[model samples]
Target: MKRILVLLFLVLCYTNPSVAQLKKVTLEEIWSSNFSPERLESIRSMNNGNQYTLLKSNPNNLFSAIEKYDYTSLQRIETIVSTEDNSDIPYFTTYLFSEEESAIILGTQVEKVYRRSTKGIYYTYDLANKQLKQISDQKIQEPSFSPDGTKIAYVYRNNLYVFDRITSNRTQLTFDGLENNIINGIADWVYEEEFYLVRAFEWNSDGTKLAFLKFDESEVPVFSMDRYGEDLYPSQTVFKYPKAGETNAKVSLQIYDLVTENMDLVSLDSPYYIPRLEWRNNPDDLSIHSINRHQNHLKLWSYNVLTKKLSLLHEETDKAYLKIKDDLTFLPDDRFIWSSEKDGYNHLYLYSKEGELLNQITSGAWEVTKYYGYNPETSVLFFQSTENGSINRDVYSITLKGKKKKRLSSKSGTNSADFSSNFSFFINTYSSANTPPIATLNSADNGEEINVILDNALLRTKLLSYEISPKEFSTLSVNGNDLNMWMIKPKNFDPKKKYPLLMVQYSGPGSQRVANKWNNDNDYWFQMLASNDYIVACIDGRGTGFKGRDFKKVTYKELGKYEVEDQIKAAEELSKLAYIDEQRTGIWGWSYGGFMSTNCLLKGNETFEMAIAVAPVTSWRFYDTVYTERFMQTPQENPSGYDENSPLNYPELLKGKYLLVHGSGDDNVHVQNSMRMVEALVQANKAFDWAIYPDKDHGIYGGNTKLHLYTKMTNFIMKNL
Candidate 1:
């Protein structure tokens, strides 16, 4: 009987669900099962506001189909089109429905041009006839359906052209556009990155005129980089890039009249930067947001297309620099809703058509993180804020008159809502550090949940198999400030034993790292490091977002000075802990954080023993004029600030093991920054390692690229620290 019981116990041990030996979660499994597999994406509400379409991908394959759902029942009644039904045309990344919903523009084979720019082959899918036809033989940008839905306007090769689907003909709108000389319909690199605009041309309400910003980049300096390929010879990509203190492209506002085929250039009072231009509700009226050279003052002007007269609407001035937000919405009544930081926090404001300040829509110490949408019918404004905690976010709705604020999401996790067209309903995507993503359909008025789309049950079940540690959230006082921080200890952590510390941060202005949200690939890597007997930590310093204007703007005029100091001080305090190995500390970051990491290794050599910076901006002089000048005021004026804070100037201080990685094709934070730093370190006789990914962008993700990167980073951390 004892031998029989022993055999049964052995079988139970091998087959027990709870006590069975579990396998460690790999990167692929974590990423694949991270989100609900059946969640919808690119959900859009039709103009009628009764129905919506969700782009759902096949579970077996990623090929997508458009499924139209009733807003009331939340039931998908029919599939409009699927890639399997038509194999001649490739799957689409996104679909844009016309105003009448008679035609849909499908975007496919998208190749990213820059941060906000892409080239995609477009096809017009007729909903009534169930027919598909390619719009152009070549890829284009900003393809928009005309007001009548019979024509489409797109930009190709820097020129604007209008195509008539019914007539099967194309008409060129502008003949002056030339590559590397003049750009008519699309924004340049600096404007797209800094101002958050790419489609430089706008369609009038009547579709009779197109207002566009023409950029003459003749005076701008050409920045060149070598693009090494498998071919025998390497090629050079040169483009007009306005660096800090360099000459910017001369911009002018022009209007193209379809009726007269005449273009008129409007001259403003000041030779300032035209950051944004849009047509108002009234077809003839256009709004232009212009900023001065110093970027301290911004003026919003309304121009009459027919009369060619410009009137100043609103002017915003700051002692530092004014931020350009995405919440610029104009109502049918001509009153506009805009966001500003004039009250020391980003708040919504209502302005009349003629620039009369109506009222302050939102006011508080907490800034609105995202302006979802405004419902004029209900007079409610939906937005997301960090009202619960600095690291947490929740959706909220307030009356347009700045009264009766109500929290839409009841959960204590990170909640974000995508409102329907009429604001009657919203799709809530909620998650926390411990919880995976949960998507649901909710009523926007009373925050009543209707249907639960995805609960990520499989992911939770899979996570139960692995031995993992919870991310410990805390606050640390560094450089006279209490900074938010999170730490992940090893599964087998011992208080008596010293472990090497690994610090990660993304110290960009108006960016947050310590958030109450699900982990991404980077977090998994950090966990992997923790599993390998290292302590991982992340700190949101003064320059990070969500706290307030004072906390974020403290680093202005001296971009890297206070940020680097706070990080160094945090490391110094962290190293004092008895369980931390002070001599074996390392730091790594990407982009802005990369800039911070490189500076930390150079400035805080005594604290950090190893550092890795990916696509870092070693010098502000090598960055764009708009972003650089906004923070540090142009290198000509703030030469001392630019030079003293740059990592290139302190090469002799790089005494630790350094590894710099960059993508050869990175348009943003060009590879020049890393190459220059590498040259400086080489001249200083500093021993370091670097990997330049061929034809990769700033994000550096591709086929087997991310795995290779993680392996390389893992090897670096193991060998160095």
Candidate 2:
């Protein structure tokens, strides 16, 4: 009888349709996609000028391979180097090819030191003998090949060192480099974040000298965070982080002679921040871009290595903060191209080697979003701008004299191009809200698609299987200004039955939340919300970028005031819709948007019913000096601006449900910001839900962590809002 019962159960399990259950959707499947795999990022043209190499990841092999592609046909001809083929070498996250293409520097085992600062183990791959050589047994930062490709220069232990590939000998250039005292060949935390500089050393045109920036941060106060691990005792990760009104690291320029092993400091007459440095066309001449403490004044100076003298070439000033661009390209003739907002909009400028302004390359109400390199042979400058609309980006080209402007991308959506070595071909990455990202090789002169690299057809088909809503793009009028907004209604949306609303935003200065772009991880979560019957919306408030300088800088001396007003007013108007539930409304944001959301819940208490703030700055005084002071100046100068607008000062106004989330290891906006707000709410006897993720950074992404966070947030919304 028991044998018969077991046989019957086995038959039922195999034959019955409902016996086997459907698989619960894993976060990995929801986040990952089966798009066409190809070599893509960190693309650079070989010195031969006919070939280029791209970093390729092989999922099956679980390793990275450097593949070289032909310039004409855009075909991956061969794998230059593959970590899987070697037994001794480890897999690298990133790599750089030397000028001669004989050696490749592989970066692996990377550990984040600070914002934009990383330490990694480097290995040199030799092509001739198929040998792999380790540059250093220890981790290092920003390893670069010499101009001759014979030696590798890097920064380790806060000092500069050069390793000879032939002799396997190491030479230390600066012995005075110490933590919080003398930093050689690398930038500090603030400079790295604000200036976007990582590698501080520059190789001279002839490979005879190296120029670097040394930061003296002894006077800077140290900010420490407790790291609670599984170990018995918690560790401390302490570093010098300058708050809004705190002291910054003193930076200076230094030059190192490779032949003599001698280092000397370059003297600049004015006190300024050396944001960028590069070797010019002349072997002995180097260009440095510096800004004042206020960041409104900028000066471009040339340093002659032979004479050890500095000459100011050009100066740019504005009433508002000066924008830093990566388009400072030096021409073969020593002339350079730089972009500035001095004309109220970002435009390109051409300057002579001696600081004479030649002509403006671009001018309009729109802003240039990207500056692709200039084709020196053809004299064409490639760039992407918002000429079509502020939310859209399209590629364009103009001559060096600012004449004969031509649009290279014919697509109406977001189109970005990565040109090849000889400017004959370019790889275009195009996408829109309704479409998945598509990458294709196209002719640079005429926008004709040649071949498709990634179409993401399978993912799109899978996405279509679920109930999804279209992202309805519209404009809202607030404070006599038109602001862009996008809304996603419920799949089974009914105009007669009101539905709850959830608004999202990232209201940082020069930021755009509503754009014609491809879907991200956040979009998938939003789709889940839409499927569950919720209205998702986002608005680009004032201070968002790509509009113009006036629109972005209007929040000067007032960070959250105008942004909160616009968002609240926009939400109020949105709630008037017959399909939206006015009473069941909520707002949530991360980082800057978190600041905006918290302020909205407090200041606009009647408008939004609930708000979730993730890693938010409760007060402007707690933010970094460069970002905060760019708009609000110093807290000493603007005390009321900092206090009156702080959400921590008005905890009593949190009338609705509030869920505050932050990561304990958020170095960008210190967890202190959220902790202070939590204390304030507790003191006011306000009930709220808050969670601190262990060892998570500002991004808050890790193994099942993002899914759990969103699930928690979803549960909160279902119960409260």
- lDDT to native, each model: 0.86, 0.85
TM agreement with the true structure for every prediction: 0.95, 0.94
The segments of candidate 2 whose C-alpha lies over 4 angstroms from its true place after superposition are: 1-42, 57-63
Across 1-721, the per-residue lDDT of candidate 1 in tens digits comes to 9999999988887676456664554556544435333345667887766678988665457487888988778788788888887776477878888888898899887887878899899999888887787889998998988787888889999998988878779899888888778898899888999988899888888888888888899889998878887889999888889998999989999888888989888888784689887889888999998899888898889999778898999999988888777788898798989888888888899998888999999888788889998888878889998888888889999988999999999888799888778888888999887787898889998899998877888877766666566788999999888999999998778999999999999898878889888867677777778888899999999888888888998888898999899899999999999999999999999999899999999899999999999999999989999998988898888889999999999899988999899998898899989989989989999899999999888989778777787788889999999
lDDT of 2 at 583: 97
The TM-score obtained by model 1 is 0.95
Question: For candidate 2, lDDT tens digit of each residue in 291-344?
Answer: 877788888889888887889988888787886678899899989898988788
